[model samples]
Target chain A: MATSIRFDPIRLPPETEVLRGEVRAFLAEEIAAGGFDPRGGYAAERFDRSFSRKVGAKGWIGMTWPRQYGGHERSFLERYVVTEEMLLAGAPTRGHFVADRQSGPILLRHAPEDIKQDILPRITAGECTFCIGMSEPDSGSDLFAAKTRAEPVDDGWRINGRKVWTSSAHYADYMIGLFRTSAPADDNRRHGLTQFLVDLKAPGITIRPIQFPTGKHDFNEVVFDDLILPADHVLGEVDMAWKQATSELAYERSGPERFLETIEVLIELVRVLGAAPDSRGSEGIGRLVAQLHTLRRMSISVAGMLAAGEEPMLQAAMVKDLGTNWEQALPGLARDLAAFADSSPTNRATFDSVIQNATAVAPKLTIQGGTTEVLRGIIARGLGLR
Target chain B: MAEADTIVVDVATRIFQDLGDPQTVNNAGDDSWRAPLWQALTDSGLTLAWVPETAGGSGGARADGFAVLGLAGAHAVTLPLAETLLGGWLLAESGLEAPQGPIAVAPTRHQDRLTLAQDGTLAGTACQVPFARDCDSLALAAEGADGPVVALVAGHDCAIRPGLNLAGEAKDDVIFDGARPRLIAPAGADRDALMLMGAAARAMQMAGALQTLLDLSVRYAGERKAFGRPIAKFQVIQHDLARLAGETAAAVAAANSAGAAIEASERVDAGLLLDVAAAKIRVGEAAGTGAAIAHQVHGAIGYTKEHILHRFTHRLWSWRDDFGPESVWATRLGESVAAAGADELWPTITAA
Candidate 1:
């Protein structure tokens, strides 16, 4: 057991618990005021600017960044509380989620001073939206295979390529994209790719909606045809984006979002089953709750590790692999457990709609962020199997 | 756990490495290794880790004792170390001193009940009592005339029916009819609390065993060759090992978290129950999944008695059934959650 992974039983501090209460109260007030329907999951359809602004007003976005960069200088655990509470409530956080979760951190870490000063405050205020441009027509999980070129110009670089499955690209003001600044080294295929902060409003950039079967327009294809960017827009060192891209994965892969995506179905299942469910329903609900609780404990442990400045890559991958699979299985289990629920019209209708949405959303839960195979491979590497 | 807590586990691990290596013990195929291992544990005062110093035992922190249990699981030591520590803790709770040798707790099964008669005698039968035949003393939690009472009785005074679990460890049925106790006092805890404690300990052990399974699976995958290459080179074997690692990781997290919560809490509330129940259920589930993958990776070797793998897989299978199986805990946890209603679910979960 020499390679045993450690996920310490890290409990939230008292301050984080206090923050959790405040966030819950804020979400409750918003729900009461009809800011957004709690039933609407935080999909692309739930991108509400006013709700995002309200959340930003609460100083939740960019919570762990430096104060000079408009962050509140909060702990990662505090941000974790806010994020999880929002997800549990199914709040319309899509408008600011990427900026708050990922983009802000990347900018704070890699962007130049002027870019940070200009965009950080706006992001903290929930006025800016971001999209990632890593996945292209040719590259998704194999990020180094990106053919999006950013040839050097006199002033900056001219970008030309297509980025597909870019979530929120249609509405995003900026994109933290990966481009092929040079050819990959023969011995190291992970070389040559570079990260840049591309202004989405620049000329020669086209955003076309990639609608889902339900007519939902979340994914998009962003074509960068001779889009010009200043030299300063290059995030971190050129042709060395691979180094920076991996450092944020532990944070990205192990968040509460990995597991809470389809929680609405479980919650609804409990509601429809009433106070005294039969043995079948009770066992089903218990197993789900137990699994969910275990995942949270593990996720929070990872957050604790992040706060302590230790990168628990193996533990984080384990959490995401288990959490996403648990969430993906929740909708179907809920359907099975609620098979004998009361047939009252309202109960049946509520359960039906929730389960249907959850079922529809299940396939992408494992695919997005990182696919299951990719995550397991990361875990295998951590186990020293490769 | 703090750096200070791991010292206890380190001691246990060293002792086990010296006298209780799984492969060595498996090869011996006799009870010869048991005596020295028990002697080493006793000499180190680990057997009384949970008992207070005033109770004639080592007054270690609860977390330290739990860590030792987890280490015991990792080694798959076929001794009654967990049972003895649990018994000592139960005795200390009632201000009673633990005896010298191994101790087994009674009323281990979920439905089994023992009672303290007004005449100061123990009555009733407890099934699935671990190491009942091997222990020198029996720590019984029984329904007294007034309330719950903790009683310590000599094992030889009771009727013991020897049985074996999946791992061939002693899991016996003990009958106490009019057996007078050496010490009996009102307990601050009930049967459920004891069960929770046992469940948490078993979860930690299962977590430990799961880690070993992962280690064994990974090592075997790397060493065993198929189609002119190490099996680990195959994407499918790598993925299976990864899944095993996931299960192992979950078990460790859940089990350790539950042990921590139990150590931190003052009473057995719903929050504590949720932590303990989740640990048992998740770790038990992990045992099944992890054992299968370990065997799958080893092919026929892991399935044989000669291999050390079965020692762990069998213990994992057996330990899950002790205290209560996953289904029992799941039902109790589900009932508690439903009783709290839908809205309180999130809060209950976050109460940690």
Candidate 2:
């Protein structure tokens, strides 16, 4: 029999509330200083190095890591507060988001001492940026099928491959590239793949922008001819990147970012609807808010489980699957709810712009991180269906 | 959960396991198991779990009562356990003593109203009152001259038109032409507060039912054979079951969070309203999606009345309509969110 899934009703502690207030005050001050626009989509995708340094100065970046590594040694929940507040305010967080969320933690756990000593401090100081190089031309969801080769040399590895759809690579200082070290075994296709931390400024490396149809320049294709990395750059064991790749996913999949991506549109929809909306409008808004709240609760519960040292991989997948789908649908739902709103020029323009941007971004939410099909497969394994 | 909450849930689970097993009750022809189940619930004080000891009933934490309700839902019992607990809670909130046998609360529907007249008689009709005909007494909320009042009235005094929900449980239309309350007191909670509380309870029940449906569907998929292999081996079935599991997890998380919020709150304020409303809406949606996926996984066997799946699914469908449907709660919640405007939406959500 399949056992029940437990969510434990985890509530944020009083300290988290205190931290949230601080974050809000900081964001408010930044907004007053014209650092970013809360209502505009421009800030969400933009990387502001100075803003990231200010956030790092506040000890928000790598807040959950050790103090010796320039971290504040705070709780994960506290870090959660800072992250969510930034996302909600549409702050320019793209500069340090990937490093703070996944790369920093991965290095903290799996990297060697010298690598950690060299890179961890820069990440915590928000002076560096990281991008994931997991997907290739034919290896998007099936990551093990990556054709990138890393041949061993004297005291280093020569990597030669192409990584497509690599976010932030154009401005990133480093890329955590997965490479094929050997041929896959007959029974284990996931073997022979290795994770290497590569400096993007290295020789024989090129980054070409892959512009979206929305005219956004966020993604890039990174080409490597003979990129060399020292032996210490490899994360965890060689040919065992698959196992290491999954450990950070629970953290990656179940954060406020997954659901809050297009929340501005929903907020804009409510503003357009005014106070006394019709039953249809009210019902639509209500269902969307309810769904958002539920996703947040589930995500927080997963965070709590992580804090308690439980690997709730299945629950995290569920959160990402449901949260991404909900966020992706927010634009359409908001469009429908705002159908009968007053046709004032200001209102129409604001709603239309917000919805248009959100709609353009919606398609990538489900496809990024882990695809919906892959997540469901993970959940099926959790359910013992496979 | 605290230790006391765990003990309370354990007691309720033990009682349900002993006397309220779904398969056992479904296989039986008559209503023989109902009395023993009620008696066991009463004996353990589970029926009056929320009433205060000062109000002549066993007192427990609100979280404990909610946890027990989840257990009751998992068992898919047809008894009036949830109704009685809500009734006792109503009476306790008004500083009135709860009566002995099974009790039902009136105004289960959000818009249903009862009035306390100058002559101390209760009037107005409460439609779709759960277990109205089966209960010994009714704990009702009525609009009084001062404000909303809670009244305890014998079930025999009022006229009840028999009705049954999709689950085949009592859902009668109760009319109070001039029924005199045995005891009436000033209620601390208003109509909206009571509705929110009741909605939260139903959300928990739906969550529990969704869990059981997920488990049954998974088990069936693992056992049922197709194309010389287990049906679960098929990628399509695995995906469907995975979706069902996701829906079930969402419902569980939402309901549990709402219950925890209610327990932590001093009163039914806007924060609690947000939690309860969200829980009700999300869990109701989950119930609809989860039941369909579960039945699909079970195939024809799950469609039959003889199967235990419908017992839970039927109640899941019926309970979604109680207190307030998804649309009703959604409208209220939506109006509030819109009124708060775009700038305050994140703050309001983060507060909860």
Candidate 3:
């Protein structure tokens, strides 16, 4: 059979357009009120609790979850608009973004009802923060090679392992981590890992900053030294995280965050170039715009598929692979275009700062979430090559 | 509406499969298959798909006609289906009745220009006009003293210089030296609108061709063996195919999005311009990247004329240059975005 990859034309519904206007207006107001700098290059890493709370109060956090669990019960496309607006405006979403995006959804799907009632509400209120603990010092892309262990104890579990490159772990209130619950069954290498909800406040937990080369500390080494977790903290079926993890990937890998990471550079490039640019500047900007628009359309189509409850894993992977590469390349493209541009001193300074930060962070865009290599493998599998 | 669209696409696909099969057409020495395929397409009312029922043509939705163009690309159809559909639409839009049989549009290239004089004479040359040699009539949007005018001129009235694109399809240069048009009327559209439509059509076709390339590459990989196993098992070949799939997916997504955007709106505004321009630029890039990867994966066999790979790949190369190459559209789009200012960029994109 031929490998069929479908991304049907899915325009955001009319209601989402209404939500988009509200989001754009809200973002404008926030910028006006000095909530966060729209020029900030890495807004996702800039933690701002008050801003997240303001966004939460607007009913955007956990917007797609069930209403009973502090969600607004909105569609994913609505959440998509809100998410994209925040990213494009460079709003500080670090405080509640993880919880709003993936943690809450996982809890809704697999967490106990009482746990969901307790934590989901706080997450929705943007009063809580969450971090993902998947990659280890040893196991990066080969997830099944993780050495993290969680031994069953008296009415609880004792976890011991170190998760490197854990974003927001330094300030996060909780971490949804994967720990080896059992050894691999003879045939299945991905069998042992099990997911658990680890409270960061619990004893025997340590978080150390992993500073970037630019001296900015956004990631952390989350060391769980015999960290105790309640029996109820186990999420989903035991020894079945392989199945659970794949489902969340469609959500994790395909968001606007993947593509718009370095949008400030493009925006600044346009600012630097000014109106009526020369052919060189204009053509460069035009190709970038065309590429950006294409990626957005593909990403939105994936969102619509997700909204319709279709698991577009392959399409989502394709989006991230293309989106991250595009984003990573944007700074370089901007620098090239800006060389020919005549900008005012203030605009030139702003452009320099923006492009510098973007170039610094460019290496991680393809490496984070899932590496380009890993994503390509997934796509190959989808193509019936494996 | 969706069901009807599916039926229409299914019918078109089936007809292409029966009459325009790539392998069959590639092996045939003569142009025998062209007549049957064009006849089947005409009998199905697909040639004038974009024209309204009141305009003496098929009244299919613009979206469906665009979809058929994509199928045409997949089959490597040698007929003037896209051009005829575009021609009929141009005539219909200007309240002019479309003539039957194959029709071709002029000024296929962005740099080319045609003009209509005050004395009702058509002047100037349109280079690389697709299927102009065989067109019964030519529909053109020429720059007139009063804005633009749509004109229908018989093919025999114009001086023709035979040319061919990479796919060996007929793309001729037509010179209208004071030739009087059979019909002329005021047009609400301009050259840009016509180019956008043409770019959009080519983008869809390139996207379809990319899909076929991917399919062919995958099948070949599974069957072609090296190093004691099928090359499909090789990590490098798999990665190549994966990248090809990514390129194909991007092209298909962008093309479908553009087609849908054009269908959703009545006018070609800034939003629609972005959609069409992006589709053309991105899909054109994909056609290049995707064709290379497909060839690399297929090895030497794909390079031969006996194989069907060139049918799609060659067409992709030719189509990329048809409606203002990527550089032209990119510059136009970039200038517009810059003119709108940085703050307005996000709003403009979101609005689209």
Best by DockQ: 2
Q: What fraction of the correct interface contacts does each predicted structure contain? A: 0.73, 0.93, 0.89
Off by over 4 Å in 2: A42-44, B1-4
Off by over 4 Å in 1: A42-45, B1-4, B268-271
Q: Is candidate 2 or candidate 3 better by DockQ?
A: 2
Residue B267 lDDT in candidate 3: 75
Q: List per-candidate RMSD values in Å.
A: 1.2, 1.3, 1.3
In terms of lDDT, which candidate is stronger, 2 or 3? Answer: 3
TM-score (all chains, Cα) for each model: 0.98, 0.98, 0.98
Predicted candidate 3 versus true structure: per-residue lDDT over B246-351, tens digit per residue: 9999999999988998888887555588899999999999999999999998889999999999999999999998878998999899989999998888888888
After best superposition, candidate 3 residue B49: deviation in angstroms? 1.1
Best by lDDT: 3
Worst 10 contiguous positions by lDDT, candidate 2 chain B: B1-10
Model 3 clash pairs? none
Lowest summed lDDT window (length 10), candidate 2 chain A: A36-45
How well is each residue in A207-228 modelled by candidate 3, as lDDT tens digits?
9999999999988999989888
Q: What is the lDDT of residue B40 in candidate 3?
A: 92
Error of 1 at B109 (Å): 1.7
Error in Å for residue B15 of model 3: 0.4
- lDDT tens per residue, model 2, B222-304: 99998999999999999999999999999999999889998888886566878999999999999999999999999999998
lDDT of 1 by residue, B13-70 (tens): 8998999999999999789999999999999999999899888999998788888888
Q: Candidate 2 i-RMS (Å)?
A: 1.0
